[model samples]
Target: MAKGKHNPERKAVRHGTEKGSVTLGGRRVAVEKIRVRSVDGVEIPLETYQALQDPELLTRAALERMIHGLSTRNYAYGLEPVGDDVESFGTSNSTVSRRFIAVRQLKST
Candidate 1:
C-alpha cells in the first residue's frame, strides 16, 4: 500500500458502485456493478458520470424504431433484449414521442 494511502486518519474511505450501460462492440451492455473507494473516503459512483449512460444510443434507437413505422406505444417491444435485470426505462410512448419531437425540431432548425 502506498504510504498514507487509504489511511482512515490521513484519508477518508470511499465506497461506490461503477454501474451503468455503455456501448461495447456496437451493443449496449450493462456494466457489472463494481465497488470503488476513494482515498479521501468519497463514495464516487461511476454511473453518475453521464457519459457512460449512452443517451445518444438510446435516442438513436428510439428514433430508428419510430422511423421504421414502429408505434411509440410499441417501442419497447422492438428493442433488442437487454436482459431481464436491465430495467427498460424511457421507452414509453410519451418519452419516445418527446425524444422524437426533440430530434425533429433539431433537424428543422
Candidate 2:
C-alpha cells in the first residue's frame, strides 16, 4: 500500500454524502461512511475504510479475505487437491476450507 504524505496543519471535515456500495468480483457490497483528513486538511469521506477498529467488522473482513484468497488461489491452481492444500495460500491457518471449496465449485460451474 502506498502511504499518503500527511500535512499536520490541515484539519478534515467529513459528511456522509451518499450511501456506499461497491462491486467486488461481481458481488455488490455495501460500505459504511468514513471520514478522514487528507493532505490538504480537507475532509474526504471514504466509502470503504478500516474494518479493524471495529472488532465485528474486522472479523468479517478477515474471514472474507481468507475466503477470497483461498478461492483465488484454488482457481489459480485449477482446484486439484483439497483440504490442507488450501492453507498454503492464506494469511492464517484458521481459514474455512469448506467455504473456499464452495467458492471454487461456484466459480467452476
Give the top-scoring candidate (TM-score): 1
How close is every model to the real structure, measured as TM-score? 0.58, 0.23
The weakest ten consecutive residues by lDDT in model 2 span 85-94
Give Cα-based local distance difference scores for all models: 0.66, 0.43
lDDT of 1 by residue, 3-86 (tens): 766545643344556556564322356665655566755665556544656667767877777778898888767877767776
Checking candidate 2 for backbone clashes, the offending pairs are none
Model 2 misplacement above 4 A: 1-8, 16-18, 35-109
Clashes by residue pair, model 1: 12-41, 13-41, 14-41
Top candidate, metric lDDT? 1
lDDT of 2 at 54: 35
